[model samples]
Target chain A: MTIIPFPARSPRRYGDLVVTQPMALEDEADDVRSLAERLVAGEEAALEAVYDRWSPLVHTYALRALADPHDAEDVTQQVFVAAWRSRHTLTPSPSALPAWLIGIARHKVADVRAARARDADRLAAVVSLPGAHELHQSADEDVAEQLVVRQAVDEMPDPRRTILFLAFWEEHSHAEIAERVGLPLGTVKSHLRRGLITLHRQLEGVRHESR
Target chain B: MSHAEPDQLAGLALDPDDASEAVREHAQTCPECAALVAAFTGTRRRAGADALVAPPAHVRDRVLADVRAPAPPTAPPPVVVRERRGVPAWLAAVAAALALVAGIGLGRIGTGETPAPEASDPTPVETDDGGEVVAATALTALDSDAERGEASVTDRDDVITLRVRARDLGDEDGFHEVWLINVDGKRMVGVGILADGDDGEFKVPRHLIDDGYRIVDISVEPDDGDPTHSGVSLARGELA
Candidate 1:
């Protein structure tokens, strides 16, 4: 099992960390912008691609907020439905996509909770289950950022994803991961590096977008 | 081509000391690689802490099913979700500017005569929505309704000058250049640079506007000398 502790990025000491290489950033940014444009143009494939990529993260948020599987499922469905209709308004940015979807999911979850409040006093149950702030922090921006990064890690393609799980979740070294996954030492290092780039790119984009 | 590959950069992210001297030196000087390493390093330790719980597979089917059927009237109407979840001030500025531009476009139609194009009148054009208009417009900052400049097409004695003026642009460490982007968003033609903030005049094949190159744009291009649009718009407006 991975360490449950949350770790923050160490402070940057040198170089212009804010100014990204435009060439590569634009390449990744273009893919995001084009997907957004296509979705706006009502291309159905874009919708499916968006769903497949982000549904797990959306579902996780719904589940955590509502704590009831049925309500979570409904909210997940409503968020995507709302996304399709309001697709025109989505900002054409990469990190904005997931963050946008999460915003919708938040709305749908609130609606479910509101409906529950109307029916009865579920306050006692909510208060007793974990800490009150934990439940309340479901809507917190920090939590959303965590889920966004977690989703990025989870969604990475295999070998990279598998390698990272071993590296981070299991605290395995490069050789350990290679031995366990039955790959050469060099191949494991390659996947590790690739995974690092993907995760960092996503993290930076989301942070920039959020800020 | 001198820049490092994404993979090499990623390797340097974890610990710069572990890297070879050449790679470390390269990353220290390259802002792009530095920015990338900065991005990669954050959230790395905490990212894998939480395992994802996959939702039931049927959820996808249900979402697709809802897409097929229109929402029932009882359901709350979907709100256009523009809550600015992750959009920065710069992008939001563009959104607001676009809205004001839309308002201005409508106003032009109301005050002008029949926008129909005369066969010889420099090819007046119509929008996709079928309203016609001349080829002059105020270029507004993409962030606000403030008019940063003006652009117009003038044909004097058969010389076509796409005269454009803009001011107070972003200081993006690049020279400013002008372009005529098509309404279709696919085609574009580069005009000359703004060249000292004066009302710069440029010439293009007059037929290009007739071919739907009606949007005037000013963009900041890096000294990279790429001669490409860079997809970086400083100020823009459709030819009204």
Candidate 2:
């Protein structure tokens, strides 16, 4: 598994947005390439390792795109199965596996949307339909935002990461998080403040870099 | 109203209940502060959304199983040969022994009323004994639940044992059950009920762990007479 190195600097203001450097993209790409090579070689354990590393990301993308947990789960399954079946076709290089997986995910998501549209059309013949193009664009944007946030969270340091996960992912109150993690309330509050700034900065930096 | 600092805006975004009147008024009037608040709120909302969930363990299992299924004769044979060559005989034997032990342990736990023996030293300190630590993971909270824990799998003379340490798991009306779930999530073996303390150990069948039952799950099961999982998992971690 690829270990992501944390950034050294604190969050810095970039005009209206606070910004920090995101994780090393180059290292991440290399990690993906290595995993894909092992997978393509038919190493069964590689499949499990890849799933452990990327399932959360894939599941999150599907959930955001489909807006239904069941559909998201189905799409996520389809994506991995398709990727594994077509592993031979993928280039054994950095970014290939993730790109291939994401491509498969996009198709699965599109299929779900099309199916839903057809069902809606049949159910209500007179209902005005929204533009599929707009929907797809928005879904892509949402997944992109989620990816940025996930990367930011994944890159956070220990206690901060745990605290932020409890706050944002678990939606726990400050007091609840402190009690659960056995930290003082004031410390939890401080971590929350710093963590949010770091996350915001990381998100802005990713958006900026992608642009 | 004065402008709110980023931290104040973040606090407001995380919990409106924590918002002071000054922060609310500042956010209402200051566009920058409002945008900051909106950004924080958006990140928090997205994080809490179901997107962060892992796919049911079975999905990976099924996908891999399908991929590994025998292909038509026309397919290349090198892949199969490579897979066969990858496993050493010694490792395979060890894996098989672990599976057998796990199976026996499950039966003992299921039928017997006695709790699985607790290690006098709860820490995963490696002993000079033949048992070795195979894998470990820090259990993370799922579905915004506040449970936190760690789990380790040990290979003791071909028998596999699971040691778990959990915290912040407040009293549940139902009992807490530990399970070694297959990657596909379709198959699971009940290791044992979690003791009311911070640390506990359960013997796991090697087959359960070897056959893709790598996810360690601790769930709150209602005493509803049903033996199956209540689906109210408090903490889960996949073995590395």
Candidate 3:
């Protein structure tokens, strides 16, 4: 089992704790991008390769975002379709492949949300599922607690939040993040620096507020 | 690369001996710098925790299904031609004379009274119709008047085939060709040329398809070969 740590990169005055290295999940982003390019090229093998690589993650995200197994499955399918159709524009730069995919997933989630909006009762039913929002929030919390410093992260603007997610969630290097997000490396670093400061303040604020 | 360059020290761990003279002195007394050093020491820990969750299985099938769909038929009916098998000797001679006269008469248009050669030839070029037919079978049905079209998940294996057809591609020499797109219509890759009355086969890389994909399309192209497919879709289809 993976061990998630408490988010304190540098605690001022507490019992010292040794930090462990982060986990390496998979090289899914590049794999997905290459497969997407091939699939767009009309190569049958590309599709199969992509399916094998990221289906699990896609399904998980779909389930979490849509809160319906059937809808999750449908969204997963649509994500690939959107990826295939948009392959030409898919330059696997800063975001890498997985980040790009998550972006696609975000859009698909919005679409599912919009479609569900038409039916207030259905929307309410979806919202009423057992710990639905809590589940979603918890999963993110789990990831944050395990890998990223979430409370600090929650303080940034959308661009910074998005960029950081692409960097951390997708494990893209600074250069990779800059390229994928279409920003200069310097700009990316500045964002990171500012974001880190903001996150620190936010975390401290939460502690203060709670106290 | 084992040691972090000074410039790379934004958030990475730092080796003690490599610490600057001032930082080393600070570590000996000042608790703050010492703590920073310790924090830097364990920077690698962050790398392990940042992975996203995995997607489920069915997404894979849907993506591959869409990627393997074939190009749609977009051409007009084939032109008909008269048979030229057997004839009587006199009739043959008369036909030859008429042909000579027609040829001579047409020559006048080209400075020597020579008739211009007939532009349309009724011969069909050899193509992989079997593969194309299989591809067509995978698509949603086509309307009788549709000129350009696509088929989804027609056939698959390591390679997927898409069959594309066009009635009369006007000045298609430099046109942007065929492309396969993901569902969002943002990610895309070029497949091949959109030749008139011919099928275009796209080779999807096995890795990409394994994850998933959705739409396939063919378009009339101008010779200015940018990899971007002009949205002028001659044909399109969704994978089942």
Candidate 4:
């Protein structure tokens, strides 16, 4: 007689899945909500666990948005602390935790902007791509187009462009993007608008010349 | 060139498919809209690529560690442990022998019965990192009401007490302790151990109050008697 052996159950009973219950990416929203509750209750380990899972993404979003390594580091730390402090308001929902983090970073970016005025001018110098003067100097009209485009992107205000990057590249939803950048939901949409429009205007001469 | 409105262009910037249909249809009939759409689409495509950056791991760790540190516990005490008594003579003798076997065990456990250390006042330690000495400032604490929820502090002439509500402590070894460090940079001492709970109190050292020190550092420490900072700071306070 042939006998079928039942799979052994995991000692931790999280749910029906006997072995380690793996959270699909889709389930991350729920996971984050639960983690938030634990964090609100002063569970340091829970906060640490949440941080380990999501900080990399937050760091990357901040690094790209703020466009400075040091600023990104500061912003990432601020984002986690802010999340912990405000965790009590977290409502369990379908939105992923990363989205919430992105929101927190948004406000943090604004705080950084308000705190560091000197850094903005410094960032403008480095972040601004070669401009019309450089194009005129190089005397390579073909190269000038690319330079012009870069200059246009660089001209975008700190963090508006950063917000765009987080939304467009990171694929964060509007609410997520809004929270991370510290803009009102409507304002976030406007920045995306203004940024895209400004870039188009800057690149118009290049596009016309190229065609 | 007459192209899409900036707001419409904004929508197109996000959803290229929608732009492809709406703007292209308009562009086919109108030359100006076509130029505007191309310019907008090209620019949007270009700017989207520069949005990626990765931070170093060590930097990430440092910032995150600072953030994860808990706010200082306030309110009433939550934990209490009295010396367990009524053990038989043989067992008590065995315990005493075991303490002797482990050289520092008895003194540490005996002291454990007393209140843990009080909070550390911020001493101006010239902390040098990478050859640059930074005026290391450790403030006793700031407790935003929203951050602390229901925690509060009770202060008398010599003893400082704190009450706190804590969560998620299952099968965890050791209690949280309160520590006091001198602001004058002369002393850093542990005044008493604090129990974790929704309503518990910690008794601080009177001498620490006598000295001009008024900062509190609370940490979750293991029962092990190692006198080193575990780097796990939870809550903090300062003398007003």
Candidate 5:
């Protein structure tokens, strides 16, 4: 529930671009570095700290990837256990722990999918089902898309970021967001519109970069 | 609604109920507008799907129990250090020359292989007199919570080769730069950028080692166009 903040000073402008400093994300980075250090030092409590911070994302990703609650729960446990085992080999940086956990999640998800695929192939041979492959493919794509969107939102600047989270994560209406955040309804609408546009552009850029 | 402005399109994408009838009509007919709306809606839908779910308490209990359990005996026995005094002068010179070549080759090859296994099983370099002269130690995390590493310093001929394998030093915005700080803490020598792995081998300048620069420090350097250390040390270990 850390509130990410944009730098308070004047927004620095380049040619035609204005760059807002990411103070909140930077603070989160500092926190991550500290947590990673503790985990590396063989402190058992640090393991819990990491789990508390990242288990939600890990679980959500696994749920989307595996498309089963039980599988997601299993993957979540596996990811944390693997992370603990390999704590000694982790890089001491803020992004390192999250990145490492995500990496492990990706691998675990892949393994689950592979296992499911083998099962599906065997079942399909005995009793053919149409659109099975298409369904699986779309589900995988959905998980990847969700991951990208989550990352973009995580990096977004203040009001827009908070507004988007309120609207989507908290399922708040514009009026509710205004009331909760103490902003004018008009301002909330404007911010939501602008935030959506920014998120769309960021997602597009990610797609291109990955390609 | 002639052509939806970026914000208008974003609004339409976010919620059709909030949009004007005219905007909704235009989106239905205009493929471009429709695509934009679809993309926005899809992104919003997926982002919303990541609602936080607290993992079951039993899972936590299980993880804690597993982690708390004593680690299995998998690692090899620790290397024992032995000192030998009667080394022939010619053998020392030959070893130094071979080390110099190996160090240069490592640089040319670049870092790609895994460093973890090699660190645990350090290859013994034989001198002309069949004596081993490798000095190594476990590098402890400095400011980080869990970063740990190992460093091995060997004298081949007169070339001082330093090999390091560090783990859990998470990714950073800037690069991880390795340095050999003098024991006196006044002077430091820049080794090189630590690659995206746990291992790196550098040919240390003889003068640096001779001058007592034995502390290995890894600092995160911001990409702010600064070449100097940002004074943010992530991990540190002294070469024995």
Candidate 6:
């Protein structure tokens, strides 16, 4: 079977959380595009709309990047406030606002780290922070792309969804998955191939979108 | 752009070292393909790399207040065109036009009537090249409301094919088979056996559809020499 765990996963399922609704990612893409348009058109309420939909994402991402919860919250606030202030000039695609916000988040994160490094006392505090020195610029860049990916996978329908979960998260071999899911080995391989392609398209779509 | 196919890009991303020489050469030469390969590499690395955490609610109130409170009053706000998600301006015109004619308006004709031709398949990840979907149905597990998979009837040229996608049907000692049962419930035709994965295509005769065999079923059949349906259905659906 050609179902090699593409990125070489951790061989661990995050949690057995139940997905109550299986949504169409296309519908979501359309909705996000509209929200982006609204934000660009200077709708103040649209910012709240954007927040209701994605505040948690930005907050969690910021929190992950900055060791301090308060720093993360500050970054999240700056990112949205900056997005609103620059609404007139912003031209990110409908499917791309998340990526754009992420772009802003990255900058805010860098600024926070930079400011901390510039001050010796704060630098001492930073040195004492948990896993602060372990942070790398490359992993920070990957935050948005990873969130987009996890969202797409969660939104994926069954069979393919379950198959991908097994291969990536659970690190199951084709033979093991075939036996476990009672599918033919070939079908599992096909599912993986198709699922991977769909994911590539989603990622490409976000990157290539001009507005 | 002289870009490669999605399958090839995916193949390269999935196993870059194993990619063909031609794919590698093209990727090296074409900027778009190279970028896509890079993007795919990133995608793979990012897919489920970590679980996301939602922030607490107190942050929401603070973030909202910070943006609106600090208003620079010196420069007046620019004239902004608001585009809300509510009813469109043209919708009012269309409604008025519909009211004028006591009958159905021409504008109302194609609004919800026809499914548009797609530039590409958005989801479902299935690879069916050119066959047009004639009829489709969702299969549910037998004796329960749980969805199993979907089946679609497609017509390419003059041939009609039945595509069944079954999921998590659970392993049984007996084989899982596909069948088309007529409405009367007595008459049925054994179409084909379901393979593993999501899709199974069985080319059915044209007359069978016209004869009212609209019910698609996947049943568990025993290894016993009985040529009949084992009477235990794993999943079934009606193609409307």
Say which candidate scores most in DockQ: 5
What TM-score does candidate 3 reach? Answer: 0.33
Q: Put down candidate 3 lDDT per residue, B2-92, tens digits, no spaces.
A: 3333223323232344345654554557665455445433332333343444555555665667644532222111111111223345433
lDDT score at residue A176, model 3, on the 0-100 scale:
87
Each candidate's chain A: what TM-score?
Answer: 0.67, 0.55, 0.43, 0.41, 0.55, 0.66
The 0-to-1 C-alpha lDDT of every candidate, in the order given, reads 0.65, 0.64, 0.45, 0.49, 0.64, 0.64
Stretches off by above 4 angstroms in model 4 are A1-30, A118-211, B1-54, B67-240
| Tens digits of per-residue lDDT for model 6, B1-240 | 467886777667766665788998898899888887887676667766566665667666776786666334322242221111343444334322322221211122121122322321222224356766655567776556687887766666758788888887888877888888654333567897876654688999866866656667787777775555555667766654
In model 4 chain A, which range of ten residues has the least summed lDDT?
A1-10
**Model 3, stretches more than 4 Å misplaced?**
A1-40, A121-211, B1-56, B69-240
Candidate 1, residues B50-99, lDDT tens digits: the string is: 66566788988988888767445433222221111233455444533443
Interface RMSD list for the candidates: 18.3, 18.7, 25.7, 20.1, 16.9, 23.7
Candidate 4 local accuracy as lDDT?
0.49
Better of 3 and 4 by lDDT: 4
What's the CA error at residue B23 for candidate 4, in Å? 20
Better-scoring candidate (TM-score), 2 or 3: 2
Q: Write the per-residue lDDT of candidate 5 for residues A1-211, one digit (tens) a residue.
A: 1111101112223321222123222334437677787677555567887897778777877887677999988889988988887777787764576567766877788788768767776655533767765676567556655765676576578877888899978889889999988989888988988877776775665444333
Question: DockQ of candidate 1?
Answer: 0.18
Model 3, residue B176: C-alpha shift (Å): 25
Give candidate 1 misplaced runs (Cα > 4 Å): A1-33, A114-135, A138-143, A181-187, B1-41, B49-51, B71-240
Clashes of 5: 24
- Give me the overall lDDT of model 2: 0.64
Reference interface contacts recovered per candidate: 0.34, 0.34, 0.18, 0.21, 0.34, 0.30
lDDT of 1 by residue, A1-211 (tens): 1111101112232232233233223433337667676566555567776787778788877777778888878888888878887887777877778878887877787678767865777766665678754556544555566777677767677878888888867778778889899999888888878777777667667656644
